[model samples]
Target: MQVQVKLFAFFREGRFIKEDKELPTDTTAGQVIDDLNIDREEVGVLMLNSRHCKFDTVLQEGDIYAIFPVIGGG
Candidate 1:
């Protein structure tokens, strides 16, 4: 399946802002994060097609999956 992955904040430091990924069937959101070497604890929000989702969320073809880093503020 092909899914569009978007990274926000520090998550895009050494990675792209957005890209289309070719993944196997049944691939979860966490799996993609692992592949990108992103720590689960650093994840602030997970979105699938603009809706909040979880790490175990199953991704589908043409899905727009976004990952945001935990925001830190004063």
Candidate 2:
């Protein structure tokens, strides 16, 4: 299955902002994060096809997944 991944904020540093990825069936959002070497604690939001989703959410083929890092400011 193929899915598009979009990284936001500091997540894009030293990496791409968006790219197509081929994953196995029944792959979860958390797996992708791990494959990308992103810390789960740093993730602020996970979106699948424009809707908010959890890390355990199962990804589908052709789905658009976006990951945003947590932002902190005073």
lDDT winner? 2
Q: Score residue 61 of candidate 2 by CA lDDT.
A: 92
In model 2, the clashing pairs are none
lDDT of 1 at 67: 97
Q: Residues 1-74, candidate 1, lDDT per residue (tens digit)?
A: 99999999989999999999999999999999999999999999999999999999999989999999887679
lDDT of 1: 0.95
Model 1 error, position 1 (Å): 0.9
CA lDDT of every candidate: 0.95, 0.96
Q: Write the per-residue lDDT of candidate 2 for residues 15-54, one digit (tens) a residue.
A: 8999999999999999999999999999999999999999
Candidate 1, backbone clash total: 0
Worst 10 residues of 2 by lDDT: 64-73
All candidates' TM-scores? 0.94, 0.94
TM-score of 2: 0.94
